[model samples]
Target: MTRVQANLLLLVIALIWGSAFVAQAQGMGVIGPMMFTGIRFLVGALVVAPLAWREWQQLNAQQRAPGRREAGKITALGVLMLMGAAMQQIGIVHTSVTNAGFLTALYVPLVPVLGIFFHRHWPHWSVWPGGLACLVGAFLLSGASSLQIGVGDAWVIASALPWAVHVLMVGRVADKMAAPFCVASGQFFVTGLMALLWALAFEPATLQAVQAAAWPILYTGVMSVGVAFTAQVVAQRYAHAADAAIILSSETVFAALFGYWMMGERLSPSGLAGCSLIFISMTLIQLIPVLKRRYS
Candidate 1:
């Protein structure tokens, strides 16, 4: 695929992911967040398992890297994913899809900062300014005074660190031992199981509730997790990494658009400004590395 084609594919994936936020929000009306997340991820795991099995068989045929399947890394990645997914799902129940989408993108700025602790290397000076922008933007989005913020926005913001950790964890293990599909399946299964435990402990989910949420659950699990994720993996093989990131970042824009169209959601002028700042931060984060490499 050409870079243009790959970017277009990435945009499609973004659209799917963005639309999935609506699915998530709608699902919350019928089922508890933990129950919805658990079933959604379990569906995703089922959808991806055959693909992982196929990838494993291909690796065996090609005698590629050891199919050792790093259990430890997968477990850690799953834990991070579970945290991120749970927070996002719960936040969506109280927050607008637009808020959830933009706030979730805060992880872009947080990723480089989080690397300091994990990789022991500080990020570029530009990253700090970007981080500041994210904070201001989030404040605007949350409609918060100096001291007060919305509970839903708080959950979305809290999810950012876990999302960053999940991204870093993936980087740390990307080339190590597991197949991509296998890792994805493992993450989904682990997250589903963990969320199930949480649901069992706190939220009550009946078969009727699950049945009521069936459509939204399937949409997120199948389209967002299985198809869109797989499409991203394939498209990135042919696209520039920076281009891929930028294209994928449009997921936030699409989320806002969908929220408005499907959910009649609207933000104040300050909130829109917040979204723009967060987007600017994400763009700078993606671009600064390439600019440095090009100039130096």
Candidate 2:
């Protein structure tokens, strides 16, 4: 596919993820966050397993079966996913999806900062300014102005840390693997199993509860995880890193829009300004380095 097509695919993935925020919030009405996450990821794994199996077969035919190390990385990625997803789910129950969406985008600037500790690498110059903007924007967006941030907003902010790690790990590990689908499936299964363990132990998930949350489970599982993630893996191959990052960030805007329409969530004028700053700074942080690299 051409770069344009690849970028378009990324945009679609953003839309799916943006709207999935609504489903996620709604899912918790009758079930625990852990239970909702557990069933959702399990469904995602089932939906994507066939594609992973096909790739596994292809790898076997080529005599290049991915090693146990890759498997381990996939498992690690799953753990990160579980952490991020669980916190976000829990936070959404207490906060608006709009807040959750915008706050979650905090992970974008964070990915590079995480590189400092984990990868022993510094980020681009833009990250410093962008990071500062994000800090202020988050303060406004999540209503920390009154010196009393909501519990849910704090939880969502906390989730950004693992998500930052997950993004870095996916680039470090998943991109190196031959089969993106296999990596996606493996991680989904790991997250599902882990969350299921927690849910069975602590959360009471009955047939009634499951039935009540069934639509959300399927929407997030099938659309968000299965299709959007797979499409992202595929699209990134043909997309410019700058364009991909910028386009993927649109999910936050989509999330806010969906939250307003479906959940009737509204951000104050300060919050809207906060969103704009976050978006602009993030785009520049991602785009500037790519442009410098191209023009040198």
Task: Write down the lDDT of every candidate, Cα atoms only.
Answer: 0.74, 0.78
User: Would you estimate the TM-scores of all the predictions?
Assistant: 0.76, 0.82
Model 1 scores a TM of: 0.76
RMSD of each: 4.3, 3.6
Cα miss at 75, model 1 (Å)?
A: 1.9
Q: List the candidate 1 regions with Cα displacement exceeding 4 Å.
A: 1-14, 62-69, 87-106, 120-126, 149-158, 229-252, 284-296
Alpha carbon lDDT at 37, candidate 2? 82
Model 2, position 145, has a per-residue lDDT of: 42
Cα lDDT of model 1 by residue, 160-275, tens digit: 78877765556346445546786778777888899989999999878998899999999998999788765665565565443444446556667776988999988778878877
What is the RMSD, in Å, between candidate 1 and the native fold over all Cα? 4.3
- The 10-residue segment with the lowest total lDDT in model 2: 140-149
The residue-by-residue lDDT of candidate 2 on 36-68, one tens digit each, is: 888888898999999899999999999977888
| Residue 202 local lDDT, model 1 | 95
